[model samples]
Target: VDFPLRGEWIYLRSFGHHPHAYDFVKIGNNRKYYSNGNLLSYIFGRVPANIFYCWSAPVYSPVAGVVIKANDGWPDNKVVNLASTIILWVKATFLFRPAKDGPDLDIRPNAGNYIMIQSESGFIAFMAHMRSGSIKVKTGQQVAEGQAVGEVGNSGNTTMPHLHFNLFDQINDPYQAKVIPFVFRSFERRNGNNWESVQNNTPKIKGEAIRKQL
Candidate 1:
C-alpha cells in the first residue's frame, strides 16, 4: 500500500514503538507551518481540537479493496492538556496491554470511528481515529487506492488529531487479528532543512516528516 496522506507529515507512534510496533502505526499530517512549525497554528494557552491543522484532513484508501467495516458515529474528543497528553503516552507505552480473551475481546470503542478494507491481496487495511460523520464509504463498498474515505480526527484513544493506520491478517475481530507489516511505494523524508526522498522504507521516529508520492 502507498502512503495514505499527501504533503509532509510527521511520523508518530510509528514502527518500533510500543503500540505501533505490536500492531498499529500512526502518522501526523498537519502542521502550522510546512517546514518548521508549532504544535498548533495559534497557541491560545491550551491547544483546542480545532486548532490542529490535521483536524478533518482528508484520508484516503491505501489499497484498492472492498470495505469490510465502516464506523462513523462518535464525536471527536477535546484536545487534552500537555500534561494529560504526556500521561496518556506513558500509559500507552508502559501500561497498555492487549486483551488476551479471544472471542470476548472488545476493541470497537477504543478504535472509535474507523474503516477496514480488505485488499485484493487479502490483507485487511485498517484506518482509525476518523472524524465522526466523515466516512464516505460503507461496508461491502468497493474502493480504489488513493480514494478519499474519510477525514482525520481526535477520536478514540488519541491525544491529538492524526491518522492511525494498520494492516491485519483477520477482519472478524480486531483483538484476534495479527498485525501485518507493510511498506509505502515511495515517500519523502524530512532532512535538516529540506525533504529527502525515500523508497520502500518504514518510518521509525517521532517528528519525521514524510510526503507520499503519488
Candidate 2:
C-alpha cells in the first residue's frame, strides 16, 4: 500500500507516546507554529483551518478496495477561538459513542467524518478527520489504489487539520478491531534542510516531515 497523502514536504508525526503509538496521523502545516517567529500565534491566536497546508490536500487510497463505510457532511470546525476548540475537544473525551456513523454521532463532539475501505485481502483501511462534503466514494463502491478519497480537515478532536489513518482486521467495530501496522515502501524524511531517503520503515517521532519518495 502507498501513503494516503499526495505531495512533498508533508509533516508526519507518529504518536511514539502511549495509546496512539500504532495509529498514523499526518499533520501538515504551511509553516512552523511554535518557534521564535510565531510564538504568539502558537500560544494565543485562533488559527484558521485554511492556515494548515494539509487542510484541503487530497487523501488518496493506499490500496485498491471496496468502501465499506463512508461518513460525511460534518462541517469543518472553524476557528472561533482557541478556547472554544479546546472546549470541544474536552467534551468529546467523555461522551464516547458506538464507533459506527449515526445520528447520535453529534453526542461525541470529536466524532468527525470518516471512511473505511476493505481490501481484497479483507483488511480494513480506515481514515478519519476528512473534510466535510469532500468524500468522493460511497459504501459498496470499489476503488483503485491512488484514487482520491477525500481531503484532510480539522474534524473530530483534532485541534488542527490532519489525517487519522490505520488498518484494522474488522469494520464498524473499533473495540474489537485489531490495528495492523504497515511501513512505507519508499519515502523521504526531513533532516535539517535536506531530505533523507527511508526504505521499508516508518517514522516514529513527532514533527518528522516526510514525503512519498525523494
Candidate 3:
C-alpha cells in the first residue's frame, strides 16, 4: 500500500508489527536545526497549532476504496497544553460519552474529524484528526489510491497537529477492527543530512525521519 502522506515527513511513533498504527508528521527541512522538526518554536507556554510543521498538511488515501465515513465539523484546539490535554481526556471519557452518540457523528473527542474507507480487500483504512472542514469526500463515495482526502490538524485528543493513521480487517465492523500490519511502497530514510532508500517496509525505526520518494 502507499503511504497515506506525500512529501517529507517524520515517522513519529509506531504500534509494532500487528497493525502498524503509525503516527506521522511533516517537518520539512526543520530537522536541520531542531531535532523536533514538527515544532517551529520551543514548546513551553501555549503553542499555537499553526507553528507546527505538520499543521494543515494534506493527507492521502493509501488504497482505492469507497468512503465509509467522513465528517469535518469539529474545530481544532487552537493551542496545545499538557494540563488541558489531560483534562480533556477525562472529560471526553467521563463526561462526553454519556452526553450523546458521538461515534455516530464521527465527532468523538478522541478523533476530531476522520475518514474510514473500506478497501477492496475488505480492510478498513482509518485516518483521524484531520483539519476542520478539510475533508474532500463523503460517505459512499468511491476514491482512488493516493487521492487527496484531507489535511492534518490539531483536533480530537491530540496534543499537537498530526495524522493518526491505521488499517484493520474490520470489514463491516469498523469499531471492533484491530490494526493489522502493513508496509509502504517506498520512502527515503534520513541519515543526518543525507537520505537512504528504503522500500516495502514497516515504519518501525524510532527517532527516524522519512519522506516519500520523489
Candidate 4:
C-alpha cells in the first residue's frame, strides 16, 4: 500500500528505467558518488559532492513532519562507464578510495536534495533525489499533508532524473529501516478499465504502468 508521495503531487520521471508497472529500485537508489559504480563502489568512493545542484520543478509534501535532516549544496559528479565484470573488480580494488573530508572527498551522502516529513500515522515519508537549492522549507517547519516540499531531479548518486519516495519507521537508520506499505485515497488504479477507483490498496506488477486519476 505504499503511496508514492503525500501531497497534491508533482509528476516526476520514474527512476526505475523499466516500464510503468515494473517495481524496482530507482536510479539514485543504488550508486556511488562520481565513480559510476554500484552502491558498494559509491561507499568506497564516499565523495559527498558527487551529487550536484538542481531544483524542485514542483512541490509536494508526503507528510507533515518536521525536518529531521536536510543536506544541500553538494555538486553531482560526472557519469562513468565501467568495463567488464573482471575489470570492475580489478579497477574497484585499485581505484576505490575512502571518502575523506578533504577537498576531493567533498561529495555528500547520496540523499541529494531531500525532505523527511513526519506523517500523522506516526511514520516518516522520505522524498529523495531532489534538485539542489529547491527545498522550500527548513528544519522544524511544519509542512502540510500533500504540500509541495521540493521538485524532482538527479542530484545525489543518481544517473538520471526521478523521484525517490519511501516510508521509514526511523530516520536515523535508513538502510536498516523497513519499508511501509500505503495506499492513495482516491486515485484510479488501472484494472483494464479506464479509471478504476482504488480505495485502500493496489498491487503493481513488474512492468505495469499505473497513474493517479487527475
Most accurate candidate by TM-score: 3
Q: What is the C-alpha RMSD of each candidate to the true structure, in Å?
A: 4.7, 3.9, 3.7, 10.0
The residue ranges of model 3 lying beyond 4 angstroms of the native Cα positions read 14-19, 28-44, 88-107
Instruction: Give the poorly placed runs of model 2, Cα more than 4 Å off.
Output: 9-31, 34-42, 99-109
lDDT of 3 at 63: 89
On residues 56-90, what C-alpha lDDT tens digit does candidate 1 reach at each position?
87888989999988978867776545665666566
Ranking by TM-score: 3, 2, 1, 4
User: Which scores higher on lDDT, 2 or 4?
Assistant: 2
**Tens-digit lDDT track for model 2 on 7-104?**
55444443231232233334434435421224456458766676665667788887898998887887788653567656665665554465533522
Please rank every candidate by lDDT, starting with the best.
Answer: 3, 1, 2, 4
**Residue pairs with backbone overlap in model 2:** none
Expressed as tens digits, the lDDT of each residue in 1-214 for candidate 3 is 8888877777666322233677777654645422233333434456677777778888889889999889688889888766666666576555554224544533447778999888989888989889998999999999999899999987787766889888878835445667887888888887877888888986667557878843
Candidates 2 and 4: which is better by TM-score?
A: 2
The Cα error of candidate 3 at residue 149, in Å, is: 0.7
TM-score of each: 0.78, 0.79, 0.83, 0.57
Better of 1 and 4 by TM-score: 1
lDDT of 4 at 174: 44
Winner of 1 and 2 under TM-score: 2
